[model samples]
Target: MNKSRFWVVGGEYTSTDFETLIQGTERVVGPFETRGDAERTWRVLSEDHRPQAQVRFTIAHEHLTMNA
Candidate 1:
């Protein structure tokens, strides 16, 4: 079986183009059990940094194998 995990990734980028992130400004939120949880965190992060035009955040997900 496989389980899905969610995370929030991204941070302040070097420019508005978002090609590269500024060193030391990268942020990785977590491996949330559900996408909804991850989204909630994402919203907070986005809103908190909304004033910064270069700051951004997005939700990401990955599947993990579960052993029985």
Candidate 2:
């Protein structure tokens, strides 16, 4: 099985909002300081989380990704 990772940009959302966005669908990969930071973190997580079939998203970016 393989998973996927994504980073969101240009959005205004709180941590709770991000959590809700990814609720029950994926694992939050981080609480990044900024969208750019989340993007960088997503790259690292893509390698590890992708193989495990665990959806990964960044709370900072307010984006979600599921296995695909």
Model 1: per-residue Cα lDDT over 1-68, one tens digit each: 99999989999998999889999999998999999999999999999999999998999889899999
Q: Per-prediction TM-score, please?
A: 0.92, 0.34
User: Using alpha carbons, what is the TM-score of model 1?
Assistant: 0.92
RMSD of each: 0.9, 14.0
- Residue 21 in model 2: shift from native, Å? 12
Question: What lDDT does candidate 2 reach at residue 47?
Answer: 52
- Give candidate 1 misplaced runs (Cα > 4 Å): none
How displaced is residue 67 in candidate 2, in Å?
Answer: 40
Best by TM-score: 1
Q: Which tens-of-lDDT digit does each residue in 1-68 have in candidate 2? A: 43333343222223433333333444455455466677776666655555443344443434444556
